[model samples]
Target chain A: MQGSQFRLEHGKKVRLANMDPNETGSLHDREEAEPNIERLKERLEALQNMLYAEKKQSVLFVIQGMDCSGKDGVVKRALGGLHPQGFQVHSFRTPTEEEEAHDFLWRAHRIVPAKGMIGAFIRSYYEDVLITRTHKWISEAEVKKRLKHINRFEKLLESSGVKIVKIFLHISKDFQLAKLRNRLTDETKRWKFDKNDLVERESWSAYEEAYEDVFKQCSTESAPWYVVPANHRWYRDLAVLQIAVDALESMRLAYPASDPELDQLLEQLQE
Target chain B: MQGSQFRLEHGKKVRLANMDPNETGSLHDREEAEPNIERLKERLEALQNMLYAEKKQSVLFVIQGMDCSGKDGVVKRALGGLHPQGFQVHSFRTPTEEEEAHDFLWRAHRIVPAKGMIGAFIRSYYEDVLITRTHKWISEAEVKKRLKHINRFEKLLESSGVKIVKIFLHISKDFQLAKLRNRLTDETKRWKFDKNDLVERESWSAYEEAYEDVFKQCSTESAPWYVVPANHRWYRDLAVLQIAVDALESMRLAYPASDPELDQLLEQLQE
Candidate 1:
């Protein structure tokens, strides 16, 4: 599948400079991709039903992206078709006073989807590494220590039946500038524009370097990072949907087996 | 609305014996109710959208019922039509070792829905008062103390922009027996039957009385308990839907006003 091309291999050095932010593999236009996007959505919904029925495993999608990289848009357009009862989306922001008291992972750990559920964290504990390191809020030694903690945390969740799919929506510096200008000019999108984004843009290269380090340190065999080219919103949505559907399909999910005394029970119930 | 009749008035003495579990007010049959249920579901979806857009207040539906009283069924049939993105359902079972280490309300308080969300707790902190009391696990004075704490906790949630709607799914002893038997005989439902339910059935009256005490103590003007007659699954689903819709409507939810610079922004975007 086109999604496999984006999956970063573990223990390999990642150079964000080498990865194109506008790559749309195989597909040439939005019209051609629309039908496939719809099909994948239907498959995702069906797979979610089986996951809920099986009640044995769960899935977590950790979505990371720069501002205006379409994190919210991908969720609304791609995986929004799943049963709301089984699918949940949580957008992480600045930690609350209570959250600040505990270790960084405490808040995320509490809300990790239970068995038979699918959860998405718009920006996750990786924020502890990315944002904290970018702002020099934590020391270099602290970043190294937190990376080890994050790897162990993902491994713990994976062992406990959570299929983790980490997706990084990659958009170019020019693309982010265009989105920011559009946000300023479009009132409907104005609510989403943040002044800090412009300030963060100045540190674009620094942020990219930080992300590269995160990929090298945290990506694992069980939960590798998929860096999606996200300049075109249509391609970004399709790629994330394909990656999610592929992850769930690979789990070999099925409904729980029927009862042994089904005929007898049916007759008794009928009576 | 027919739902108002089921909304227990605050400070009034509640007698479960007086409330007919089989009562189907204003509707003679399921066909008569189906259309109204559909309308209510649509209204609920619209209201939920407004609530989410407003992003100021949240709604919490605390669903309490006996083992066979159809708590799960009501959620699926009635509220299931909601946009899954804004609606969340959390089913509380026995507390884990971590949950047990904290106060009873600690675990529940942490998971309450945030602003612009609707959360339903299949069973809630009320378990501390009901099961704990029925089994004499906690002293009567302790139950009284916990009841006060619960009222306070609910008020806190209300002050922080939560609309609390407590629902008690009232079912007759005979009706429960029939459902239990169906679970035993029906192959698909066999997994739902618990041996402990039979043990708890022996203490049905104690549970009922304990529930009555809870209604008297915990029911507040801000958050009243609605005793939904649950003998007929159709009526139960419809009534809960009606009550939920009414509570959200009473909040008078509205989308945030359009931006003041919308026209100018549109002009700029067009350019």
Candidate 2:
């Protein structure tokens, strides 16, 4: 229930300066949170099974964060327990020419989860507003127009029974520098280091401002955005798991109504 | 080591009558196999990380079997340990209208894993030979022609740094019957029982004959088909996990060569 505190209020003027990326409410360390994390993971897996059986609704976790914010880690640790057959993860990176030729949402719209499945999008369509705005790729008027279109597109998906949970894995500037340093020094992790990440790190403040603007404009009641403190890896995974279980539980998922015909089929199968 | 026994020799005539679905090598029970399965899973994870780091080669596992042969279950239990970001599973069901218009390999070619990723096709192009031949959907000559094309297509993938490990989950007819009965009788599992599966059960022998023909024709040295005994779920998972780990290990996965520049970047960050 404490995960609800991170939900940015709809239409509120949001600011990243107010959040503590190291905040792990009431939990001291990974040891304390391990049991609860396991419990919530089981709950999530069970709820996902019911959702798959019902075939009525789907859940999408929209994960957005800077390079070291652990967007990929959260998905692997939290949502990975769902039956892989019914779970999918799509990471949105630099768009291709074909994707750019279409509208901004074209690439994302193509990969939306069907009913009875859970999907996690890493670095999702929000990058259009966050990265594009920070880089000044589109005009201010166009950015505002695109944000409006995004709100409407999400609303359309909500109407069609897609429950969206948007999360921003908030990590501090100091933490990112440490991560980059660690990546460079660790022989095994050196492969993950991209020099472009250093280039983007220069626009840190601008990216924050851009993301704050997005939070204010598009965080709706149906699909609210949660800014999670992600510096503490264990707490971040636990919080995301809680948030996922809460979202699926709220859907009131149930198996489809039992059919008497199945009983007849069972009798025949026995024979 | 025992998993190799299941590998049907390339171009050799394969017959279901010569094998037992309940074979578990020397292991007697699930408890005995659990530790080996766990070890293979960890080996698979480590090898996968190396493969992702190398980013030079990809591995594809082509899974095929009868309807109740546990194709979906094998994917979840055996290969699900993989990092979700680098692992993709695409189940090939009935093709779309456009897919039917194109060559049989088109739908499959599009989804093959790029460098440093692993892909599993639950039912693959071999279905063109097996099901199409069994149902008389294609002429006998056409089936043979398609099998030849499949051989060439797989060879092309192999030559281009793709390691293919094809698996057949060989469950017995009585085993499938028990599974069907369980699906109908179990309230929670009733959703999985399709009426058409029972309809297809009538052509069980035809499907077996078709699969044997495919094994004899398309199972080549570079991508030999493994006819795994899948009656015992525990043994099935263990065998598949061993096959996957062995395939990845055989690739000689290694991290990319270290760059001299990253250490310089690390010092600059320290400043």
lDDT of 2 by residue, B1-271 (tens): 5557778886788789678999988899999999999999888988988998998999999999888899988988888788888888888999999999999999999999988889999999888888788889999989879988998998889888999999999998899999998888776777888888887889988998898888888777778889999999999999999888878878888889988888888888999
- Tens-place lDDT digits, model 1, residues B54-159: 8899999999988899988787788877766677888889999999999999999988999999998999999999999999999999998999999999999999
TM-score of chain B of each: 0.97, 0.96
**DockQ: which candidate is best?**
2
Docking class of 1: incorrect
The digit string of per-residue lDDT tens for model 1 on A168-188 reads: 999998888788778766544
User: Which regions in candidate 2 have their CA more than 4 angstroms from the true location?
Assistant: none
Clashing pairs in 1: A84-B84
Model 1 residue B29 CA deviation (Å) reads: 8.7
